[model samples]
Target: MAKKHKPRVKAPKTASPGEVMEIKTLISHEMESGQRKDRKTGELIPRQIINRFECKYNGETVFSADMHPAISANPYMAFYVKAGESGELEFLWHDDNGDVYSHSQKLEVA
Candidate 1:
């Protein structure tokens, strides 16, 4: 079974309408590159890493990123978005092994 991961997100709870705010995200992952040999068996560790990330605000995509093998473990990203309305901010991380990590935060516009 694939390992479970914890995702972290930082977003403002409230903002002025049309204001740009910063959003931060991070996820814990091993990010094996498949080039390294296992110490015990001397076999290559299968490559497993988060390959893509997406963020949506109120059902509209705000930011997205494509990850590569060169990306370090526990990937972190920060981006900005304009405050629209009181709604949900959804985040998703896609792993090479077909595992997806999800997180959500709510933002209220004043």
Candidate 2:
């Protein structure tokens, strides 16, 4: 079984309509590239990494990224979102092994 990962997201609790706000996200994961060998067994460690990341505002995609093996563990990303209305900002991370980590924050736009 894959290990549990912790996802973190930061967004403004309130903002003015049409305002541009900075959003930050981070996930705790050990991104193994599958190229390294086990010290004792001398076997290749299975590759495990976050393969994709996406952000949605009010159910609409705002930002997305495709990650590669070269990405380091605990990936951190920051992006900008233009406030439109009060809604949910959802963050999702897709792992190579069919695992998905998700988090959401409410944004109140006036």
Candidate 3:
């Protein structure tokens, strides 16, 4: 069964134009590395992890990261972005099983 993944973000809803702000994001995932065995059946667990992560602002790429098997479960990321204008921020996570999870938030600038 496929598990549902969810992304959480912490960002200011409003910011001053040209001001720098910190953005934090986290995604829920098991991050199975295929090296672990099931205690019940002693079967090798298939690897499952979010292989990539990206954040975009107004269709423009702002930040991205390449993930690996060594990554820990429930990945957490934090970055900084300069305030520009009112727009939407899009977050995307790519899984090894060809799955993509997305989250979006709106920002307002004065």
Best model per lDDT: 2
TM-score of each: 0.91, 0.93, 0.90
- Candidate 3 lDDT over residue span 76-100, tens digit each: 9899988898999889999999989
Model 1 regions lying over 4 Å from their true place: 1-3
The local distance difference test score of each candidate is: 0.90, 0.91, 0.91
Give me the displacement of residue 5 in model 3, in angstroms.
Answer: 1.0
Screening candidate 1 with a backbone cut-off below 3 angstroms (N, C-alpha, C), the clashing residue pairs are none
Error of 1 at 28 (Å): 0.8
Ranking by lDDT: 2, 3, 1
Model 1 lDDT-worst window of ten: 1-10
Residue runs of model 3 more than 4 Å from their true location after superposition: 1-3
- Residue pairs in collision within model 2: none
Position 104, candidate 2: lDDT: 89
Q: RMSDs, each prediction? A: 1.9, 1.8, 1.9
Residue 16 of candidate 2: its Cα lDDT?
98
> How do the residues 1-110 of candidate 2 rate in per-residue lDDT, one tens digit apiece?
35558888888999999999999888988889999999999999999999999999999999999998898889998999999989999999999989789998898988
